[model samples]
Target: MNLRANERLSERIMPRPHRRFIFSTLLLCTWLFIAGCAVDQKAEVDLYRRVLDGRVAATQPYVEGESLTLVRAMTLANQHNEQLGLRGEDYLQSLIAKNRAVANFLPTVSFQPSFTIEQRARDGAPSGSTGSNTTASGGSYQDSGKISYRTEAPIVGSMNLFRGGGDIANLQSADANIERQRLLLLDAQSTILLNVAQVYLQVLRSERAVEVLRNSVSLQEARLKDVKDQFANQLATKLAVAQTQAQVNGTRATLLQAQSDVRNGRHTLALLVGVDTINGKLSEQSVTDAVSDPKHTLTDYEQMALDRREDFAAARAAVVSARAQVDAAFAQYYPSVSLNVAGFLYREFYADASKWNAVLLANVPIFSAGVIEADVRSAWSRLRQAMLNESFVRRQVLNDVRTAFENLDAADRKTAEFEQQVQAAKEALDQARAAFANQLAINLDVLVAQDQVLNSELQLTGVRFDRAVFLLDLTRAIGVLPEVTMQAATRPATLPGLP
Candidate 1:
């Protein structure tokens, strides 16, 4: 009976300890699950921030169709162009150069005046005439005291009669340089505008692509479920499910890459317009409107490029400047004449000493060891080089026109071809699904048809975007731009739509 009582006590103790152990185990698992969920949330936030960093925010809110325009982009580019506007230093330099040129035509005037008091010895040499001499007395001194005052004032003037034409050539060169700088500023503005447009288009395209891929992933997931169901029923092979899964994963990877590109494109556009945005999604753009207005044909582009391209004009200007330099270099070998004159006013202790003095002098270039000859040769060579470069650039511009025209044509054709493909694939997909419903087609065939449709849709979207990009490139290459109307640059295209 004592043994039986001990056994009962052991059983009671065992049940309490076992229950406590099970409760502790359950608590630990709950804590681990909560900790894992927190880590996943933190990771998602980081990804969001990274994506936000790449995108440009709209400066102001507007609908996609009306927010930004090409004319507006040009305006913003010009307004924000760092080099176009005149600065204090630029004005100062221009004035200095102008003054130097004007000085060649005007007389320089300056004043020289002075006053003094002096004592002269009786012997007629102005001096203190101090000397110690022995006298009849032990210590006697003799000193001379005579005071006089005198002053003289002079005004000087000078003008260059000739510097063989160096001064004139220099003035002409300065004017040419100023004009060149102006053209350069315009060219820079054009370049910036083009960059803004391209980046903006890229962002828009990327965003749209992301959206399409998201939809594609959903479709892929749904198809995956159907394939798994078929496999479970032994009507579809395992290999079919695996193929669908692979396509889904591949598409997901593509989606990720598209998102990354969209982010980077947005960042570039943001910096161009000087926006300071972070941690916010970029707004979508309607690139269709911006790119829809292209009107120039290949021939038109060639003609316009030859006439309107800023680089071509700048090249011609450079050639002219180089020729001017040659002339200036040759002119250095000739003589130059300058005149100098001076006048003095009265300023003296004595009235007779106060009078005006004037003088005139001429200067000329004498000689330098073959320096002028070398300069002329160098200038002539540069002129030749400039001319050659101008020709080369013209040819390059022509080539670009041809290439852009070809690309534009190809893009147009591809858009049409892909659209047709998408239509055909859609019909095929429908037929496959109907056949499967009637038991005449397998699930695998339907899945294949769906993939083909998705691929065709993706290709068509890509082709559309390519056509738009080509349009932009052609516009830029032809040096044609619509007037910019906005106060800021635009964001890039959003992602493309997927199947």
Candidate 2:
């Protein structure tokens, strides 16, 4: 009986132990897999950070002047203006031309050496006295003047003259071109900065919109739960409950769209900030202020354009360049005077010694097949075109200024109106909620109030964002942005006309 009992115990205990061991092994493998996954996730996160170096770098250095706002980001982009490979290539080419221009003003020198060797003999006798006295019958004057030597020396100098100032004009043109590129680079920087700011602001607005929408959804969800509870208690009708549920579902769908907008806005910001095209994170400003409307006088705006706009300066420079080109064209009609100097040493085997010769020359062009006339015509046409373009840009800039100011004034008023609307809507929602709590209003009434509140919130957000956008446009129109070495974006303290 004891042996039988022991066998039974062993059978049960051995199977149980094997099962426990297998289970433990499986759990261990699973844990290893989860741990490995966590490590990989961390690595991917780090890789994304590395890819968005520009955005990350923008926020670093512990924050300096103006806290490195989006405006400063624009300035930074300008300072770090890079256009794929074109800008660098342009810079390099300009540098080469500049170096060549500098070299042209310096002296030019060269070295040359020539030698002549030959074996010669006169038919009867050599031209010298000794050769004439030699016997000619001795095997056809066996005196072969086989002389060979090398002349080792060099001569070098330089000369400059009045060539209708063509070289000067060329150098001037190069300098102007460099200036033009510099201005263009400034313009590029401004554009990139504007893009970054716009995208960054969009992301901020989208995020806020998402948060506000989420709050709305939560509020609706709470109302839906209350309506369901009331319907169960027969205090609220089924229709009212169904309406609340439908509203909640609709809010959820809208929430999804807002989230998508946020994601896309962040992606756009990443692209503008030079963030890697791959996976990257976007950092944005956290601003919660009422958008304000500001008005600027026309005179002030025009002054701002003249003083701070790089485009205006560039246009003016173009006019100067056109005038210079006209001068260069006219200069072609004049004669060019160039002084030339050349020196050489000549050596011959037949001569007793080497000979040296030096010469100076002057040249002028007295006639041409109307090439100068054609050039003058081209230059005049260019000048006229440039003048027209300048006028057009100026008019456009002034119009932009006027439009921006008007928009700013309008945005401020709209923001104020919307702010009032939002406040009234909030009050209405509160009253409806209170009435429903007291059983004086149905669930449908409360849901409608909630929807109104949500709509008002959305409207308010849009108005605020538009105000900001208009402000940016106004600043740009006045050309105050590019002239600003640093950015100081002033967030308004309160809504216009708000207490």
Candidate 3:
């Protein structure tokens, strides 16, 4: 009895037609909400998974106990540098933009489904008639209530018929942007390689300086001992023993500084190569051997730089993209035509129907408060800016090529001069030591000779390293650094002077 009473009460509150319409609408809304939540949850899960994977990868150990050669260093820098990775991501984004440009030529389709329930009331009673005579006369009579339900499902599609070649222009612009990004990536690679070479050479130079200072310290210690023994025999004065001891102390200090430099240089090199520590011994002789004489004239190198430099190329591509933007802006002047097709389904208390329609639309802009004109002007201005940038970059490239060539030439000359000085200093030191042992020269003369030898050796080491570094700079200025292959475990490529 209670169930029957409840059923009657529910029917009175909501008639059958109204209840059905409400139920259907609620069901559709619930399903759509659930589907949207599922999609969002799935995206969240995938994002978390990627984050976890990145954390694991970051924790993985890098290669250890491997020789860090110049080529290997460059390879690792290219693979692991954050800046290069960002450049790659930019390139990928440009590709996505290109895809979007292509999609503009395809038809767009969308669906809109709706359900509505409405309660309406109407009065049928004349304006001047009495209550019972209102229906008899040509006047409004009684009031009646009506409930209506409406349902519609329309699938609409539209395709562009004509847009004054704007779509084509946009696609071309996207292509130009992609090319620009590629050139930028190449530029970054060259820069990173040059940096690696510089730090690697520095490490070698510091290590060599330490070795030379160590030898000098050992020689000074022997000389100090000799002077002390002569003093015991009263053949050498106390002043001579003290002078020798001072020379030994100075040599030891210089050695300590050189050792410090080696440590700092190695740390910097390891950072550049994206490793925990740099593990290989850098060969000073190998670095000197790798210095090659410049084969081309400055003019030739300048030409090469202009041709191969990625910055110049990217600038040119930017101009092309800007020009495309101008063309796209001009397309707004012409009429745009598109074809649209739509279908609908409706159900109600008084009507049930289905309908389909197709439309051809052409929109021609007659006035726009100068909006289109301003866009064209803005695009043209950017194109002009790009052109000016291209000119500036060309001049800069030429200047860089000439400057690097001159520096390399100067380095070569200095290296040769230092080599001669080193030989002369060695001869002077040998003669001075012999004379001092024979008591024909003072201990001060031996110390002076030793100082000359050390200075000459330090100068020679500096010039040799400078020569190698200048050569690298020359190659980088010419935009022709040797390419290193990126791989899981990269092998060193053939450097300019390496077999």
lDDT of 1 by residue, 313-381 (tens): 777877877777787898887777777666654332224332444444445556678787889899989
Estimate the overall C-alpha local distance difference test score of candidate 1. 0.62
For each candidate, what is the lDDT?
A: 0.62, 0.60, 0.73
Q: Candidate 3: misplaced stretches above 4 Å?
A: 1-62, 117-147, 238-242, 283-294, 345-354, 484-499
List model 2 lDDT by residue over 1-499, tens digit each. Answer: 9998987654433334444544565576688679866635455333323322322233332122223345545534443334512443454465457678667666565544433223334443444322321223221112223322233233555555555766676577667665655554444455565566666667667777888989998888888898888889988888998898899899999989888987787556545544433133333442222223343467777776666555666676677667667777877766655444434433222244324434454456567788888998998898798788778878877888788778777887988988998899889989998998998987778888888888888888887777676676666666544333232344443212211
Better of 1 and 3 by TM-score: 3
What tens digits encode model 3's per-residue C-alpha lDDT throughout 383-490?
Answer: 999899989988988888888889889988899999999999999999998998887899999999999999999989988888788877877787666432221123
**Would you list the clashing residue pairs of candidate 2?**
none
> Which model scores highest in lDDT?
3
* Runs with alpha carbons beyond 4 Å of true place in candidate 1: 1-74, 81-103, 109-126, 129-155, 232-235, 278-297, 344-359, 438-444, 482-499
Which 10 consecutive residues of model 2 have the lowest summed lDDT?
132-141
Considering only N, C-alpha and C atoms within 3 Å, which residue pairs clash in candidate 3?
124-140, 124-141, 125-140, 125-141, 126-139, 126-140
Off by over 4 Å in 2: 1-72, 79-81, 84-106, 111-160, 277-296, 342-367, 482-499
Question: lDDT of candidate 2?
Answer: 0.60
